[model samples]
Target: MPGMPKPIRLLSSQLVDQIAAGEVVERPASVAKELIENSLDAGARRIEIDLEQGGVKLLRIRDDGHGIPVEELALALARHATSKIGGLADLEAVASLGFRGEALPSIASVSRLTLTSRAAGAERAWQVRVDGEGRVGEPQPAAHPTGTTVEVRDLFFNVPARRKFLRTEKTELGHLEQVVQRMALVRPDVALRLTHAGRGLLDLPAAADPPGIERRLEALLGAAFLEHALRLDAAAVGLRLHGWLVRPAFSRSQADRQFFFVNGRAVRDRLVTHAVRQAFQDVLHQARHPAYLLYLELPAGLVDVNVHPAKHEVRFREGRQVHDFIFRTLQRRLAEGGLAGTEAEPGAPSPTIDQRPLVGGAPPPAGTPRQAAMPLRLGDERAGYRFSFAAQRPPAARADAAPPPVAEESTAEGGALPPLGLAIGQLSGIYVLAQAEDGLVIVDMHAAHERIGYERLKAAWAAGRVTSQPLLVPVVVAVSAAEVALVETHQALLQGLGLAVDPLGRDRVAVRAIPALLQGADAERLLRDLLADLAVHGDAGRIAAEIDRVLATLACHRAVRAHHRLGLEEMNALLRDMERTARADQCNHGRPTWVRLTQQDLDRLFSRGR
Candidate 1:
């Protein structure tokens, strides 16, 4: 039996196509992404997408780009055939959105497909038909304008198992719509139209200028994002990043609004994601996601686009440099914006310590300068719904230190002032009530101080280097074969994070050391998470970011908490710092720390305007 030979056979063309289809056509939206990418690559200025039964029954994409010629119509359905790339040099850069020729054949293998195209200046249009069995029909003259239309019907008609995996119409439609949204976001200059079940779902007009682009954004991401968004544009080290991110005040509970593109291609790169997270970590409220639409562009030779069949993922040759660039740029933008509800930017340095008995990070537990926080009730009868001030007294700080840095903005003369105005007095033990030129300013004392402390921790961590500790007993962990391979290759990455990992078994690794700071942390879980992050980032600098979060925890514990009484000067000092500090509008958890009500706003509240 050992000597018996098994005959090797080539798979049928249909089966080969079906196998490739499995990778390219995972769902209805997968088909949509490929076809739409093809349209975009064709230089389509106007594209129409129509779906029926969530694109399971039908998917018709029409584009006004340069249409395919009649001669290439049949070749378009052939496997491994594409006009995008002609040689090795062309494949290296791959500027077009669609290059690999698997989309048409893969889609045709699982569904009924018809491609009709009329090239520019052609007298008549031509069409080619392909069956689910990969059979190609002869081209025929068709009535059409100078454009192309790809109509896919009854997806997975020959594969019941794949069809069975299809979800409800609404769910599938949601996925399809997301693909369209990503496309729409990047190509603001292209007019897009989407129809579902015979009714128009989305119609985006082409916008060529900044204001027009903003109008398009408002139509898609909602007015709140537009109102709060801070525009960011910068370039460095052969890379350019520009886009808009809503302030932390407008962040959503889920990462629904985040969109990042590289070279006009939408990607879910972990390096970019980690950079954004790091930039906004201190100011972003925990468990909330930022809202943004950003673009990063670099030379094509520096990145590989052929790593994945669908091209959703890309590999960067200079992952570390790219990661740092994005992190630093976004962090600076968020800081300068001063109110990063969701717009990304790094934060000022602040010490985040571990204060378990109180908050996450604060000063020394018992013997530090104590500033009792104050709060104002929303609807209290006494003091006209405001907390009564009891002889203002500043919080006690170390006698050795100078009072919080101050640049005077207000005096007894009562003149117009800055946005935060001048600190007037304390309210309750949780809020700082200040008088602005227009009306009143309500400050969440705990929130504001927490942001201040968190920024300081970030600064401290960024300025210093990570110190890793060697483990007395190396911890071995189970892993996939790929992970083992990854561990072997990215040993330097681990070393940088102060971790020493060596492959143990075929699918396991031994952790001989860890970041000195991450000691007593779940070595197994942390390693796995780090491995996962590495898998996504491909060594996009995770150690510094992980340490920053550790600092965030420290800052949370050390920041001032609610119920601590603060004096008039302490309140004013906090206000001044906030005005100067980056991302002062939100706390570490990404919630707004203060709000301003102008005199007009106050008058409207009481009907005084009438």
Candidate 2:
């Protein structure tokens, strides 16, 4: 018995592929993601999916896009074979969403996979079938349209371990629905039809604009989300962030609603999650999470696609900038009149510009206090839709000794005003006015200063210039095996931030100095935070970033806040420095530094011709 041939021989290449499929194909949702991506890559404008019993039974996907040629049918089932990547260099800048050539083989290994494709120029179609044993059958002639049709059935029949782990039918179907919803958001131009157990579940046609996309989302996710959603669009910085952020009132108890994508690929990234939470820190309760569908676009090379096995996490070359941009852009948009709803009121007619005077006459002098002469009243009857003051044009300029550092403009009176900058002018004791070259600016003295201080601290850390104060008493931190590895790799960078540490034992470190910015902090909490960051970001580059992020937060707490009064020179100096900084239009965390209102913008508010 001892000399008998070993029963546990090395797994054959085919078996190894099937084993790898265990990680990639968890359930019906996994197959859906890969198959739908194939349809999208084929340039399909219309896609229809039919599934039965959460795809445990028959699953069929039909598309009307340019399909594969007859000759390529057999090669399509081969392992590690794909048109997405060519040579080794393709791995470095993976552009397509489905680059790993494992999807087809993995799916085929678990289910009885059948592929039927017909290229546009070809006269005939071809079909290929792969049984559960990685055996390829002979290709046969088939009758089909000029597109591909993939059918998968009896998933996990060969792999009992996988099939046993599947959840209830309803739960699995819910997960599948989530996959479809995300894909629809990514490709709004494609018409997607989904059917479950012969019952139609979702039918989304191509949308004309972002609003149409939102409407489709409302139909799928719920109309309540749309009521609380805000749209964000910023085209500069070689990136675009367009999606909806739920209002504070509609915050969810769970974070499952926070969806983010890069170049149409959905990802669950901690950097993005942390940034969003930071933006909503003040508004939402600790247990609540803001729901958002943020789409980011940039050159593929700028992002690293090899971060996760599931392809749900990406590393950007400038992740800090991207994170900052998204957080700030959304927060600013939310702050400025709540993103001006595009959906009109149920019955009210749009106002015609026949009586109301046009705004934007002349720039008001800096320091000249002003308010809206006539605020546009909404339809709420209790507020009484009536003008509060006699509208008049503001004079262009006025002479004063020091030139008012703050400025305000009334659009109802035909005055152009820029968005309020960080700098403040003392008005009525609390109100701060901001001055621009062409218009007036107004701001909340307290909130603006707090945000400014927070940004200054963030900038210092990003530049690797955080000042560390030496600790008179050293603290010791004890951790586990993985945490010790993290501490050792990040020792140098941590020291640079004023944390003096030394290995105490196999799984412990003695902290000699702490970040001066975080003086008198809880040593235990700091150590725990360091370990947590290391666990999530398990690479050299991410570790360094984590160190800087920790230092930035500490410095922010020590910086100045807005409510603190400042002299004339101080306000002027702050504005001057802000303008000179790189990305001065936005803060370190990606929020805008200011918003401007021009004369014509005011005229549009009133029923006036400019």
Candidate 3:
């Protein structure tokens, strides 16, 4: 009898509400998120939040949205009571941010809460109070504006275990600020103000115009992000995605700056992340994450937002279609940014180069086996500065070999200068300096050449020009029956990628041939990885990525290296090639290939105005 378990019994309402609180409220940040979402759903254009002790002691939120009538003040604090949805059909196509209606009761169960509101046509405001014991008091007359105000005090005060789990005041406040930031990003049309212990922390006005949006971005994400970011506005197949994507050069070390919202609700979806990562595969470093603030607008019925209690994730009805759309749109936009003489997006102003002095040196003495410093000067005495450097010339081009022929359009003297301009000289045998119509262009020869080569190789591969080499001995791999079926079904697709495989038995496949570029790769391992990718993504992206990786390696090896001296004609040819290549702005390794310094930048460097 002592070891026997207690009889089964129904849990009390207070206990059930507290249990629900565990899922809805993780900390102060969670509370803020839920409350703010409710305010947004109520059509509040301006909301104010005041926190004390990182919202553990007090959280007061005021919103000028449609308020609840006096009759519903008590019902508003009841679990599962909400105006957002009515029945199962409404739940299936939820449009509001807060539909579960558990937030108020769950939060009130953990702390003392006061709710005050005045309906649209109400003559007076009504107030209701709920204690930690889940006791709802009768409504009483109160003084308030024509909206609603929710005040939560002593969070987790009744639950010592949850209270002790809270982090430091500063740490909790930081989390709260991030929640506010996310809200501000998603609802740029809503005004938001946050305060901590009577001190203003964030104040963002509604941004309705382009300039206002840019200013808001600069204030929230910093001037550097706004300067380096590209505008994106793309729509297809009943879906619309618009936002800013930072260039590769401005990629973040962490994913802190990545924000994706679905129907105005911020979420972390695997399908979206995978698509974005694949889009940046060729131009971004593996260790870095692309920074973007993208908002996706689709019909509410097309996505299920009830997957999670916090609604931090969503499941699309057509997952594959959504993934492909996001990938193609971003990839095309990035490629367009590489075009010559064009900014990332049309009508978007080009970013001004930071003011900085250019420092370089003359070549070392001819036939000097050992390197030594040498000084060179540019401009008049007032604007000139001495430069020094030492290095050995790279192999490839001879000093007296004739320069390659240039196109007539490129070399025409009377015509306008090309986007990259005319090559002036080689600097330190590593950079190519050019004179442009409006400024100076400095190109990293090695990096630029690598990108050009990679793009060409990709083009050739895409055109079915990549040859296949039969393996000396067919490599057989044992896999699942499902994988075997997959291999046989996708054989045609595989053959197009220069991969030839035949099913040997129910669970075995033999790889007969592979791409010529991947001749020495481990055939069995490669096939396994390819199969895994196809099974997951249902596409040839895996094989394509593999081929691209090998092609990138070959390009990097054959590209011009540092310390390579080039004739003016050769430099000009290279620049023209860069102008014609896709994704030429960055090398295969995600490094910038060139930079522009306008005449204004030069003036600033020389203190001309001062």
Give the candidate number with the greatest TM-score.
3
Can you write out model 3's per-residue Cα lDDT over 1-610, one digit (the tens) per residue?
4797989999999999999999999998999999999999989999999999999999999999998999999998999999999999999899999999999999999999999999988899999999789899999999998889999999999999999999999999999999999999888789999999999999999987767777777678776565555566788999988787776755777899899999999999988998999999999999988988888999989999999998898999999989999999888766654342223345333422121211221222222111010011111122111112222233454653423323233333345566667776677778888766667788899999998999888887787665789998999999999999899889888898789899988989999999898889999988988998889888877778888898999999999988766766678779777766777777898877877766766766677877
lDDT of 2 by residue, 1-610 (tens): 4687857678776787787688678899988888999889888998888999987887789898899887788788888789989886888888887878788888898899999989988898889899888888888999998889999999998888889999988888888889988888788889999999889999999885655766687676665555445555666588877666665544666776778899889988878787776666544546766677778888887889877656878998987787778778765544432313223233322111011111231233323222221111112122211222222223442322222434333221224221223343545433345654344545433434444555565556667665666666767777887777778888776766666667777878777776665667676567667668656643233333445455435534553454455544455445444333222332334333344444555555664773
Q: What TM-score quantifies how close candidate 2 is to the native fold?
A: 0.63
Q: How many pairs of residues collide in each model? A: 53, 12, 0
Question: Model 2: runs farther than 4 Å from truth?
Answer: 1-10, 235-237, 307-309, 334-523, 526-610
**Cα lDDT of model 2 overall?**
0.65
Q: In candidate 1, what are the lDDT values of residues 412-450, reduced to their tens digit? A: 333435446567655656778777655677788888887
lDDT of 2 at 470: 61
Q: Rank the candidates by lDDT, best first.
A: 3, 1, 2
The prediction achieving the highest lDDT against the true structure is: 3
Model 2 has a clash total of 12
Best of the two (1, 2) by TM-score: 1
TM-score of 3: 0.87
What TM-score does prediction 1 earn?
0.77
